[model samples]
Target: MSEIRRFAAEARGGTPENDNRRVKDSVKRLQATVVEFNYLRSDGGRVWESSPLLSTCRIDERSGSLQYNFPSGLRERLVEQALYSMISLRVQWEFDSKYGLVLYETLKRYADRDAAQPWWSVKTSELRDLLGCRDKLTDWKDFRRRALDPALEEIDRLAEFCVLVIETRQGRGRGGGQVVAVTFQIERKPKEVAAATIRELEKPKVQRRGERKAKAEDIASTVDARKALHFLTGADAGTRLKWVKRAEAMGIELPKTASVVENLARWVPQIAAALVAEERIR
Candidate 1:
């Protein structure tokens, strides 16, 4: 390969000088860029896992020009056993929402066929961490509306997946349970790059037994359950006990022998409403 002209992505504070004749604007470069990568072992062996391609990178001005340097070993890996892919610069420039960016990369994890699964489950708490909204967007509904839904909409519109769906884990005896995890599905992949990705994905997954599970607090209960249960019966011990039996009779199953709040928070308020209606009619 031969060298070509290099220039800054944007001009460095190229506006009129201020009253003090000192440029008030600061010139800063983006901290990161997205890259898709493939990995191979020393003997040209396939590594069946998608790896994190983003690394510490910086732009330096030397010899009156800009230079890009990624962390050590990154260049060697790319040269020896890796290939990289990048999306359009305009696409990167136009993305405004942090949620959209978080999800866009998450979906990239499963963007290919054979190599990457079409759908994958990640813990919701892990997703919160990935989105950098940890501790801030704690409420599920608010997180979904303010960050997740908008991200989905924007990514579905602009990104390669075209459509991405997120659903809570529901199966076995776990239906209507707290959303401890999220499953992601992609409707379509980018035609331009997907062929290469699918070819890479044809490699088998490198098996490593017993990966550590994500650390999340046990989903002991829901907020609705607490208020509804309190409303169903007053603070009296006998009343709450009788109502628990009544709730069970209504097919509102609760986690057996869990904390009182845990049991109360598992089901909806329909059972309580039923008791209220019966009392009113009498």
Candidate 2:
């Protein structure tokens, strides 16, 4: 129960009673859920399966512990899987809606393609099914406005990939010339930008007012320092620091009054250029 509580981002910062209630509610939902699995075999065969998500679920109120088990067949298949997608829990928890979360996961499966322009396409109805809103949003405009558009917007902001709606419609459209299919192009972020995004997401979701302000200030200062370092040196701070240590070993010294960047600027120009070029090549 404690581990589950810790793993659930939403359970954090709530009272013990509230957390316990939330956990119980989640368990009930899991036990009651019937999931369908559609697997495509290597030889072009398809496997369709439906089963209860959980075979059993038990809770001990006094002990504050919970126990659950996946259906045996589901467990076996999961354990024997040869390939799987890795989803980041922090990113998943940051999604404000289930539509966004589902869309993000669906897109992530195609993120590793080696194609020059990676993309995923599906019939509008199929996408609606994937998002579990097949019958709910009957109108195309309502579906796109209320579900698809918002989901795509959230994914573009929070996900590692910048998704763009590259194509829609195949032939003459039906249903008042509605969009029949949708396609999205996925592009991965640069390393530095992705790293910064990860750092931002890693911060606690709930923070005191003062703490949040302080963190914002600290992050701003860090960004400023990085920009300053980049301006002063051809390479980033990390690359320059590596060579700074090498410079110190070679008997190059900095005055007490000078900062690391100032001394680096004053160092042998040829050596600095060489170091920067080497770092770039690496």
Candidate 3:
């Protein structure tokens, strides 16, 4: 239960009881969900199959543990194929909507392609199905306004890759042209920026906000100063020097290694608390 809450970014800030309720709701939804798969075999034969997402689910409130199993048929094929997407839970949890999350995953599938310009085009209907908004946002205008636009905004802001809307209209009619499809050009961020983004995501929510506040106040001269000491301990010499410089700039005298080691028990927790509150307002 604790692990589930930690990985589920949305649930991390909630109370234990609320988090448990949310987990129960998610488990129930998964148990009730049905999935369909269509496959083409090497001999040109086709197979269509359907099954519940989970065959069985059990939860023990007293033990605060949950157990579930996938449908047997799907489990066998999954084990045999071993095909899956490796998505970052941290990034996925940052998305504000399901559309953004789904679209991010869809684009991630093509992130490894060697093409100079990687893109994906999907029919409006097909996209609606992928986003699970087929029935709700039936109208193109409503769907684009409420779902597509917000999703694109979130993806561009939070994802490691940004999406460019290459095309959307096809036929000439009302509103300039009828919306028929969406084509997205996937552009990966620079290596350094992407690495920094990953590091930001890995931080605790409060610490991240604190760092942002510190930056906003211009209190820290170097970005490396905001990094926790533990992270710098394993970093290269240049990185460690930047942290030391940051401390010096803050009017703090550096203690020798022997003195620091002797006072570790007294100062470690205080250092952690200071880091958390350094950028706090009032």
Candidate 4:
């Protein structure tokens, strides 16, 4: 029973009789939350298990797009449903720390790359933009009321614990219950605070310039000189060798040039041949 029925019963002119049904209905709102959760667990499980290469699921706010970043192929299976879920959720509230991590982990399993990176580490400015509205709900009750309509049609807002329920003449079967109740919480972070907090969510770290230089050198060492020659030749073979020693050290097998004019004369054919071979030019 809702507090409304209890209040009406105690009042002098109150008609508690009709309140009986209203109270019963209100309680079911809480129950729907549980039902939605089960549905999500079941359906979400299927998506994850079936589509391993699909990762990086996001609910876009501006255009209300549910973008999925998958390795390949897997997205085609779920893209339509993913879009449906995104539309259903209405995404009234932004994802927070706990909920964000859950989504990140869930989607990461389907991603091609390492899913171990924390949600905060994903560096998606677009997501942050979506989350910008977190602190904007001034009227919680009004907001909840408006949100309830879509929740039933769309998604499971675990953080809010809300569901849209529809009453039925018989039992609440499929297509019987309209969206009715929900369990959702609203965050009231101030604009300044939310902005500051989100910024710290992805702070850039500084490293020594020398360290960066060394890392670059290390990366350079792994270059395949023969492969580079192949590419250069295909590109036109006329490209000048800026660093003769470095090219030679890279095993490019190119002659060191003391004179630019002489180097260009010889370099063009070498580059053109490499290009031809790359293209399998007979």
Candidate 5:
């Protein structure tokens, strides 16, 4: 009950401190909450168990303080995972307008890159509620244009990571197809904190998993090379060679000036020109 109350508070945009505090007060008020479990026991017997999900809860009405305890390590882990789908860079509130902010927070929850995939799939209804979308609630195309696309643009431009969103439809014929889900991929850029490093998310509407992974690898290599290339272009010729030698000694496969100049991706707009001007082109 307390956990549900905390979610309700969070959905209504309460501060984290308040969210935690409310759980305690709310839990104490609930008559009882039940927890059910089914698992193998240590003695080689399968057992089913049921207990109060909130076994212990206390509240100090005057101080407005509260206390609650979790049931088990696994239960705690489940709660943590449910609460934090993703760890994100602290985003500036105003950088994203209301729609943009909603979208960013929603996607940030699914920003788990270490997973088998780098994307999230959210049902259309759930996505709408999550974004607090009350106006034009039935219009899919308009929602995508007014809310989704602009939000994507803002998050990509303002945040450290960029994302792309696409939608799928359900049903058929007669009443027209309803949108089923919205899927998108999040890609992290270079570590340098600059707007220039933000890359556009331009994969096609229907990208295969393998292709998505290939693009990810390609983007990663270019980002790495861009870092090295940026340093080399800004340094004196002597320093550039010294850096290259040190990098080689460290067993790093760097972009030779020629390779960087000739084959660099378009995202690194400055590097190739700098190399060409310096007569470093192969």
Candidate 6:
């Protein structure tokens, strides 16, 4: 592709002749046309083939612009040029990930103490590197283990699945046109993550002691399994049964012939156990 550069300046000289001469000389040296091609036509029987060399020459007594068209394939050339640019970008990204950790940590510290930077300005190479390292460690540990661990196996399986996709894509015609489109996923497959990204899409669960506070303090001790059962019985039986029938009619998959009192009694121990460690249940 041909390189194009433009030269224009404020009319330092006094006369229009000087201006015209300078502009004419500049245009002549560039091998460019001063007149619009669309306006000019062949005289008599002559056929003037358009060279695709177009130019716009603005000659104001003060200052103006000189524009020109070089060739037809400029757009394709531009797109090809972008491929090299993106390659350079990917290289820079990898380099940034390896050596920019200190810079990232410093910026994060500043953000913690000061105003937050705009999202566009916040670099993510270091955080990505940290997460990648943690995942690699997790994989290494899994690989060395004797048993078939589900979490480790899931990671390995995902990796192999990706490799398979890549291989299949490469087998397609000509260039590997694997323009894989990715959407932001919540990373729910593993059901767990290391300390870093774990906070991103999930939060640490908080445990509460089994106690009723404030207004319910007086009734807390009395709200037990036996009392709960008696309360259910004393409540309008017809009303409770009607509510259950309504739930079934609404296509809600509820346990049949099971009262709320019976269901709560059966599940209370399990629910309490899950809320805290078994040793902490007391």
Clashes of each: 1, 0, 0, 21, 0, 0
Best by TM-score: 2
Cα-lDDT of candidate 3:
0.69
Q: List the residue pairs that clash in candidate 5.
A: none
Candidate 4 global CA lDDT score: 0.37
TM-score ranking, high to low: 2, 3, 1, 5, 4, 6
Clashes of 6: 0
lDDT of 6 by residue, 221-251 (tens): 3344344444444556664465456545655
Task: Give me the candidate number with maximum lDDT.
Answer: 2
Which lDDT tens digits does candidate 2 get at residues 1-282?
A: 766776675456543443577787888888789888776788989788998888888888778778889989889877873434688887998777789999998888788666777899888888888899978988878888899888987676567887888446555655435577888888898888688667656666543335556976777655544444464466566755666666667777755522366664455342444444554532
Whole-model lDDT values for every prediction: 0.54, 0.72, 0.69, 0.37, 0.60, 0.33
Determine the backbone clash count of candidate 2: 0
- Return whichever of 2 and 4 wins on lDDT: 2
Q: Is candidate 2 or candidate 4 better by TM-score?
A: 2
Candidate 1: misplaced stretches above 4 Å? 1-63, 73-85, 114-117, 169-175, 189-282
Return whichever of 2 and 5 wins on TM-score: 2
Give candidate 5's TM-score: 0.38
Task: Enumerate residue pairs that collide in model 6.
Answer: none
Candidate 2 is scored at a TM of 0.59
Model 6, position 18: C-alpha lDDT score: 30
Clashing pairs in 2: none
Task: List model 3 lDDT by residue over 1-282, tens digit each.
Answer: 776766574555544453477777888898889887755688989788889898778877778688999988889777763344577887887766889988988888776577787898888887898888978989887998999988997677577887888557767887768788879899898888788767767777567557657865565423223344444344466644554555556655566541243333333332333443553412
Instruction: State model 2's lDDT.
Output: 0.72
Q: Over the stretch 37-83, how does candidate 5's per-residue lDDT look in tens digits?
A: 44456798977666666556666655655666666743653575554
